[model samples]
Target: MSQRIFHHPVLGSMEERTALQFQFNGAVYTAYEGETIAGALLAAGVRTLRVHEETGAPRGIYCNIGHCYECRVHVDGIPTVRACMTLVTEGMCVTAGSVLPTPLKKGGHAK
Candidate 1:
């Protein structure tokens, strides 16, 4: 039996179609143009997003609201972003990691 696919609110509520192609684990995933990486993954029913920092334990979307910082991912060569707070872009690359973040500003914002 074939199953049905589900889309998220932001993607489903759009006035027009906005399908964008991206790769995850060498496989293609289709998400709306404005959806975030984690949102896409979550909508796809993907749990256990990444690993633990030191204990190497399994980790995933702890705070679907992006407060726990457990869903950090490397997007397009940049690290330290809350996947729950970022929007997906076409041709964007994403990587998963579980290292304790350093106390430094990556983009060199004004002090």
Candidate 2:
């Protein structure tokens, strides 16, 4: 039940690669070598990579070429890592981004 494109009409079959293990939000998942984090997650049926910083809305891969920044996630304690651009490696830990807290004004009102 993987979402990988095994056979393409133009590109033919996908290349064989070594399988690797990675963790996303505390759960382990399998990914092939040379695959990007966003690709692996999508293959594992994970759509929502993170949430909107202010609205708390679910966010997934949009403009997956690394230009949209919607697929950003935390990797190995590093913040704002683009999942679409980062390659998946064995033992890599990935966490979904969360909504940021609202700023408060001088009188304790949200800004």
Candidate 3:
């Protein structure tokens, strides 16, 4: 089942667009031309885009308009690209962000 809005109350029906294929976290998915990466992923049933850098908690699209950075993902080797803002293209590579290793405790020493 796709999460795309086929018919909007005000916007009416969605336009027919060319289908494009893209890779996300090593898996291939279909996206329509002019559709955002986040939109495509959501339509494909992918909710978590990345994890919190500090806590490793799952993060997905929050403010889809680009206000929140929760939808940030690596796009085509570029780090921290907003999935909601970046449009999906054919053969594009998208990698979900992962948590960074935390620093050692104040009294701890590295071996």
Candidate 2 clashes between residue pairs 3 or more apart in a chain or in different chains: none
lDDT of 2 by residue, 3-83 (tens): 888899999998888999999999999999999999999998999999998788999999999899999899999999999
- lDDT values for all models: 0.71, 0.93, 0.93
Worst 10 residues of 3 by lDDT: 102-111
lDDT of 1 by residue, 10-69 (tens): 657334657877765455666787777787877777766667765668777877788999
**In model 1, what are the clashing residue pairs, if there are any?**
none
Off by over 4 Å in 2: 104-111
Output the better candidate (1/2) by TM-score: 2
What TM-score would candidate 3 get against the native? 0.88
Query: Judged by TM-score, which candidate is best?
Result: 2
TM-score per candidate: 0.70, 0.89, 0.88
Order of quality (TM-score): 2, 3, 1
Q: Give model 1's TM-score versus the native structure.
A: 0.70
**Model 3 Cα lDDT, one tens digit per residue, 1-111:** 777888999999989889999999999999999999999999989999999986889999999999989999999999999999999999999999988987865578777
* Error in Å for residue 25 of model 1: 3.8
